[model samples]
Target chain A: MEPFRRLAALACPLVEANIDTDQLIPARFMKESRASGYGRFLLHDLRFDAEGAPIAGFILNDPAAADARILVAGRNFGAGSSREAAVYALVDYGVRCVIAPSFGDIFASNAVNNGLLPAVLEEAAFEALTDWMGGAPAELVVDLEARRIAYGGRDAAFSIPDAWRAKLLNGWDDIALTRQHAAAIETFARERLRAFPWVAPRTDGPRGGAQPRSPDAGETRAGGASPQSSDL
Target chain B: MPATLFDKIWDAHEILRDEEGRSLLWIDRHFVHEGSFHAFDTLAERGLSVARPDLTFGIADHYVPTAGRPRIADPKIAGMVERLAGNAARHGVQLFGLDDPRQGIVHVVGPEQGLTLPGLVMVCGDSHTATHGAFGAVAFGIGASEVAHVLATQTLWQTKPKRMRLVVDGRLAAGVTAKDLALHWIAALGADAGRGYAIEYAGPAVEALSMEARLTLCNLSIEGGARCGMVAPDATTLAALRDRPMGPAGADFDAAAADWAALTTDPDAVFDREVTIDARRIAPTVTWGVSPEEALPIDARVPDPAALVSEEAARQMRGALDYMGLAPGQKLTDVAIDRVFIGSCTNARIEDLRAAAAVLKGRRSRVPGIVSPGSTLVKRQAEAEGLDAVFTEAGLEWRDSGCSMCVGMNGDRVPAGERCASTTNRNFRGRQGPGARTHLMSPAMVAAAAVAGRLTDLRDL
Candidate 1:
């Protein structure tokens, strides 16, 4: 992932609230390989008609938005589905940052992991940014170090979790970071296992453990009772 | 200070807190599906293996074929299932594969197999992982990157989300269900209302819900913008967890139940936010637009954008109405549907099947539809109860389990411009397929739609 410091790029506005991940890339196109690029599939349904022709009126279809790298979106952007492919679609399509009033819990974290910034501003600030966009492409500077978005000589403060900012700025591999606390994790795991044996994975073999296969679907178990059905 | 159930679980699992106050919390359970294959790639890129493969379980459902058994007709989809199996094999992670009797939607399979337990901190790559929180678990969704991080470290670095209490008290009317309550809450509160908070569903009506219904409630928490949704464990939770092939047994089970019983919010615990609803007020609600919040009661008419309070909201409503081909003041019950789907992580359990089946018992559906159970066990249970016959006799296809039309990834798609009455959680544009419109409702409501060939109120049926 590219380390994000500062990016001043052309921006487009998609100010529809609750723009879900299914609409971001659609479910059918998620199987494609990242090597081939997910850019073309980004907002595939929104950008095209049933016949696959690009909708002339769609903002992304405009020539000015052809090089857009930032999106000023509506509240609760990327609201449904935990598909990181949603973030991949944006980054692959050259969107480096998204300014919104709020974001889906998982989508925002996914953005940081993939070097895309999820800049959260107040609803008023987001509205101002979208108004400035005014159905036309504009240039906005997203400074990760400064935690601000600069547009038309006006700067708006944005917020992201401090940890996410750190991750994006350093382009750090989380696994590598966690490994540094290996000793502490080891101790914690041991204590948890000792205290809550039932909480541990139901396994019968060595370290990697055997598959925790259950009884056949036809077999009835004697120990547990199914919940007394209320109406089912 | 009084503690919330979330705080109790978070404190128990926190290994250490970083300078940012982000805790590296141990993950007791992690679920992966076909969408998680990307995470495996990340693990390979860094030359790391799953830190606790034993705790992680894989289910092949997202892209697995619903009609076919072991044979996935489409090569691309077949590869997805194959890759999942191969990944589970390589990691030594237990997989409820395409052929496994336990195979179903990941959320459904987790709770049924006793893998999802109270007080356990769980994570999955799919958003509906919150479904397990009905058992009092602190379960939430993760992205592929965090999925990979959990695989390699068995821990996640997360800043604690503020806690919120969503209380639903009073009596729920007949035909109203957990699905209705979920949608009703989302409609009452904007889609972004629960953002940055882990919401706990409380109050008497929530308590009265069956385990299955409770699962349905927590399942759609993400739609309301909650980080996760939970219900503190009670007798109902204990009964549900009783004996599972994977859960502890005998004395161990009793011990665990005691601990789970203790996992409740203190009476004086203060939430960062609280919203209470009169359960009696929620009717059989359904979505009228793309977003979950864009819904109204069955008796209501289509909303007029002209009457909306804000210009942006009005504009968005206009777009939704345009896409839906609905005119303002049009009766919601008068809307017609092309097909119906009664399945998804949201509403595909055995109880959900029974509810739909009860509505379809002797009546034939007016339109074509599919009735896919949540899991093979759920299917077997339905078959044993003769519910399969009810669905088939009612003109609905009694298909096998997998995500099916809810995601439209495995060839079960709603055609272009067709409107469907679906029990699936999402009603987002094209969620069922390209140009497909979906109406989110309960399984019983979906069955009602099937019989009426439109989005009819279950009460009307």
Candidate 2:
């Protein structure tokens, strides 16, 4: 993940509230393996027509907004599904920051993990940013360490959890963050194992407690695995 | 101290609080599925095995085909399943593959096998992991990075969420189920109402629901923007866990029950926010637009954008209506549907199947429909009670357990531009398929729609 500090980039304003992950990247485009770039499919359905032609009216397709590296959307952006692909699409498409009134909990976390900044602002501040975009190039500066977004001498402050801010400043993914608490985790695991023995991990290979020769042992040749006749 | 149930659980699981007051909380149970194969691969890439494989369980739900899994026609899906199984094997994690009798949706399998217990902190790669919070646990979904984090270290770094209590007083009307309750709340309180808060569902109506129904309610908490939703454990919850395979037994069970009794919110507990709904006011609800908050009662007409409180809200409604191809004044029941789906973690339990079966007992479906049970146990139990025969006779396809048509990443999908009445939690645009319009409803309502070939009120049926 890239380290996010300060960036000044053109902003694309999409004022629709509750912009869900499904709209960010449709399910059809998600079928391909993760290796294939998702940038082409970001907002695929909304950006293209049935004939696969770009819709000129869509904001991203507009010539003026074509180089936008910051996206300004309405409240509750990324509001459905836990798909990190949404963030992948945005980051891959060169979006460095998303300014919104709020975000879906999972989507916000996924954004940080992928080095995309989900900068939250008050609804009025978000509206001010979008309004500014209507007349001129909306180039805004986002300073993560300072917790502020500024444009044309107008400054708006935002708030993020101290931990998330730290992660962004340090360019740390969750794995690295968890590593910092390794000793505490080991101790917690040991204590929890004794406190809740019933919840221990199962070593049973299959239902019968026998390891099968095939990795797909329980799976049938065709229609997948079927229940044992006795159980059925 | 008078702590809410969420606080009680979070405080108990705290390993260490960071300088920022973010706690490294221990994860007692971690559920993974095909979607999490990447996380496992990341762990392997780093040469780190799952820190506590015993605390982790994997299932092949997301990519397994519900109808004759048959080599999973999609190579990508096939690869995911194979990878999930192989990863689980290599990491010493127990996996419930497609053929495993224990296989089902990860959320359903957790509770049915007695793995979900009171006061246990659980995490899953899928968003609906909040479904486990019905057992009084502090459970929520995490992204793949967090999944890898938990795999390498059985703890998650977290900032405590403020608590909210949604109190639903009075009894629900006939034909109303937990799905309706959830939809009602989301509709009343907009989609982002629960943002930054963990919600506790309380009062008479929530307490009256069965464990399965409670799970349905909590499962949709994510839809309302809640970090997680929980119902305090009581005699009802204890009775549900009595003899389960993974649950405590004998004196241990009694001791656990006694411990669970103390898991409720203190009588004078103060919530950061509180909202009360009259359960009697709720009817069988359905979403007519692209978001869950766009829901209305089954008999209600689509909302007029002019009636909205703000121009921005009105514009949003107009856009949603345009995308859904719906008119503002159109009656919900007057809308025709090309298909119906009755399964998902939200409403695919035995009780949900029985409700759908009751509606379809002697009736035939007027359109194509599919019924995928939540888990194999649910599948077998439905068959034992002849619910499968009822569904099959009604012309709905009875398939094996998997998250079919809900996430639509699997082979099962609704064709583009088609309208569907689904029992799934999400109603986002193209959730089932590109350009596939979804109407969220209860299982019985889905059955009613299948028989009517259009959205219909269960009360009228």
Candidate 3:
């Protein structure tokens, strides 16, 4: 993941509230691998019509806003669904920051971890910015180190969880950070098992779990111990 | 200080706490569906293996064909399901594949298989995992990055959400289902009202709800902007858990039930926030616009954007109306629909199926629809009770269990420009399909809409 410090780029406004993940990248587009890149699929349905022609009026489709990398949207932006690809689409499309009044809890987390800044402003402040900018193309400077955004001849502070800011500024991977507490986690697991063994999956209930395909089925392969069968 | 059920659960699961009040809580059960292969990709990228394979369960749902086995005609869709199997097999996680009789939506299969027990932290890759909170669990959804983190560490760092309890008094009026109750509250309070809070449904009305109905309520909590919502364990919860395959049995079950029953919120415990709702006032509600909060009673008309105060709000309302092809002052019942869908984590349990079946019995639908059960077990049981005949005779398709049409990723989708009366939770713009409008309601209400060929009131039917 990229370390986010500061980004100054053209900003586009998506004026609707509750812009959910489905609209970010439709579910159909999620069928392909992420390696294929999702920038083209970002808001595909909203930006295009059934005939696949670009809808001329959509903000993202506007030719002037084509190079925008900062998205300023309505309240509760990125709401609904825990699809991380929504963030991927934005990051892959060169979106460096999303300014909104609020965000879905899961989407906000996904954004931060993927190195996309989900900068939040008060509703009144967001409305003011939208009014000042309207649908016009403008460049906004986002300084993660300073926790401020600069545009329209003035700089304004934005708020993000301090821990998340720390993570992004330092580019700290969550798993690697959590590994420092490995001893505590293992200790808790042992103690928890001793105390509440019944909490585990007791597939031994009346119905009985008779799952097909054993976990150890790999041992039963015929001279296919490794991926070298053809070579042999 | 009196400890709430949430406090107890949090205290028990905390592996470590940081200075910012974020606790690294140990997750007990992790449910994954077809969408989660992305997490597997991340794990491989990081050269990490699943830390606790035994606690993780994989189920095929989002991309599985609803028509029947071997009906996944789209190779891309087939690859999603196949990759889930590949990941599960590679990681040694127990998978309920399509061939398994227990295969279903991850949220439904967890509780159906008794894997969703009280006093545990359950996490899933899909937003509807809150469905498991009905069993007194602290279940919530995570994104693929967090899913990968949890897969690698079996713990999550989260600031403990403030507890908010909605005390709903009075029993629901006849024909008012939990779906209606949830939609009513979400509309009364705006969509973002419950943000940063873990909601607990209390009071007599919540206590009187069936276990399945409680699951339905919690399933829709995310739609209301609450990540986790729960109802305390009672007789209904115990009865739901009894003799299930993934839960404790015999004397152990008895001991577990006693513990679960005692996991209620303490008397005199003050919640961080509290709301009082009169259940009697809730009507059979349906969304009129794209958001869940854009809902009203069945008899109400579409709201005019001109009446809205905020410019931003009015702009959104107008945009939603334009997308939905609805006009202000139009009667909801007069809004005709092209089809109906009756299956999702929100309302696809056995009880949900039975309620829709009761409404559709002998009454052929004027429009086409689909009725997929929550699980294959639910499908077989519904067939045994002749519910399949009810749906088929009414011209609705009888489908095998999966998250069909709800996510719109599979082949099953409401066509472009078509309107559908649905029983799913979220009604976001194009949730069912691009250019497709969705009006969400309860199963019975969906059935009535299918009968009337419009968004008609179930009571009138």
Candidate 4:
């Protein structure tokens, strides 16, 4: 994980929203391991034709956008079913950020968690940015720290809560976040379990059996229970 | 200090705060389906187990086939099923597995089983989890990681979202159902209109809707970019909640009703943003463009990029129109489709099936298509009432349950380059598959279009 402190303008003129997960990474691509180049399949259904041929009409087909790393989309970008492949696709296709008027809720979460900047801008600002990139290379500076997206020599500020932005910039998931509190959590569990033995698992040697286990062992076993539902 | 309905509910559910200051909101109910096995695996690897599995419930949906075999033969799918059972048993969570009469799509079973109670906060790893919000719950879909978090600790650390009240007044005209209203709202609100907000679909039109109709409204909340969409619970909601497996029993029912009555917003409350739509103005809308919000009435003409406000928009619109095989200025009804698919979380319930069957009873599909029920129960009930016969006789395949052709998760998919009139959400270019153009429509409208072999308006039929 690295601090996202820099701003670089990388723009693609294409504007499309409600881009589903399948289009981000088609179902056929999931057959491959996540360790493989799943990013290559990003926009598999959109960037290529049935025979894996490039569709000239597709926005990604334009020669100018060949190296573009940022995409500007219309309202409601990333709608439909929750498949994380869409983020993989965008990231794999060299897009690190997507600027749109709006994004699907699930899609936005996937983007943030996967370290993709899904910046929501005003409709007019989005349009203006894309319009500026119509002929020349579209440019936008995404400063994760400042929470601003500058385009066309003019910057538009947006806010993504500091915590969420930090998680994305650092590439840390929930597990990483939980690890940060592991020591404190462990102590809290040990203390709470000793005080509330009823909720803790019993470690008493099966009835009156001569089991060679310490009494505190059973106490700690039951005390190990975290304050969360285990599964379903 | 006027609190929006969303904040009121969010505040009520706050259990504690973590060191990072994120509010640990208590989750009243947790829903899961077959696709969430990965989350369970992640938990196992961490030497952790579900702490309060009793609140967790599992249903067999998503990957389950609608027909062919009662049990899946695919080793991976079978393994996933076994994992769900094993996980539920080990964690002490209740599961409604396949063959259980209560087994159905997660979204379908939630309401029918009375598990999605009003004022409760419901979370599922599935996007359509918003379907539970129809009961006036703070229902929303979470990610697999979040799902694991909830399973381990019946709570989620979340920043509270703002609220928006979409008041659709006036009565709906004939042929326009809740599906139509939702589609209209998504189109009018520009698909992402509800972003970062929880939307309460209120007003006379919402209250007048049946429980099933309300579910359809909330099911598409994710499609319109809202965290969740809900309607205030009323007598209709209470009546529907009755007789379900987990519904309130005996005197507990009366107590629950009193609490449910208070779930609604105050007479005068402020919203982060408000958008009003005239119910009467909406018709049996059909999407002609590539996005749900880009839809137009059947009578409306295909949009011309030149007429757009921005050059960027014009270019994108031009591409969408070209990809859709629709020319500018062409009537939406004039667009012919190669196939029709009417099944998905968006519109795959019993009522949706019945509505489509009613339109296709004496008719026949002009193209090859299938009418997949959302679940085994929906398929059984449809067959029990002869809805299957109507579909089969009309040249439409009456397949088994599961999300078929919606996202092409399974083998069922539309061929590339073929245009399809689908009742499922999203009309993004090639959303069905590569080269497969999709046009979103209501179930009845999809049936009408299937019979006509094109995008024909239900009004004309």
At residue B293, give the lDDT of candidate 1. 91
lDDT (10s digit) by residue, model 2, range B1-461: 79899999999899888787888888989999988866876897899999888889998888789986656787778888888999999999888898787889999988877788998999998889999999999999998788988999888888899999999999999999999999999999999999999999999999999888899999999999997999999877887776566667676777677778889899899999999999999999999998899899999999999998988779888988887889989999999999999999999987888889889999999999899999887776667567788999999999989998998788789888899999998888878987888999999999999989999998887
C-alpha lDDT of residue B225 in model 2 = 97
User: What stretches of model 1 exceed 4 Å from their correct place?
Assistant: A203-232
Where is the poorest 10-residue window by lDDT in model 3 chain A?
A: A223-232
RMSD of 1: 4.1
DockQ for every prediction shown = 0.39, 0.32, 0.29, 0.13
lDDT of 1 by residue, B350-452 (tens): 7788788889989999989998888877776666566788888998899989999999888999998998999999888998998888999999999998989
TM-score of the second chain, each candidate in turn, equals: 0.99, 0.98, 0.98, 0.95
- Model 2's CAPRI class is acceptable
- C-alpha displacement of B155 in model 3, angstroms? 1.0
Clash-forming residue pairs, model 1: none
Return the clash pairs for model 2, or none.
Answer: A201-B54, A223-B70, A225-B99
- Provide the lowest-lDDT 10-residue window in model 3 chain B: B377-386
| Recovery fraction of native interface contacts for candidate 1 | 0.54
> CA lDDT of B211 in candidate 3?
84
Candidate 2 residue lDDT tens string, A3-107: 999999898888778889988987656556667787888998889988999998787888898799998888999998787878888988889889899999999
> Can you write out model 4's per-residue Cα lDDT over B1-461, one digit (the tens) per residue?
66666677777776556555677666777887766775686788788888557568988766665566576766666665666778887887788776665566788767655667887788998877888889888899887667877776666778767788899999898888888898899877767777788999988988998777898899888878887888888888887765444656555567677767777788778888888888999888888777777787888898888888976578778878887888999888788889999888778877788889889988889998988877655665566456778889999888866666876655577887799999887776656766678888889899989988888888888
Order of candidates by lDDT, top first?
1, 3, 2, 4
**Candidate 1 structure quality by residue, lDDT tens digits, A72-180:** 8888999998999999999999999998998988899889899999999997887788887786889989999999999998999999889989889989877888899
RMSD of each: 4.1, 5.0, 7.6, 10.6
Q: Which wins on TM-score, candidate 3 or candidate 4?
A: 3
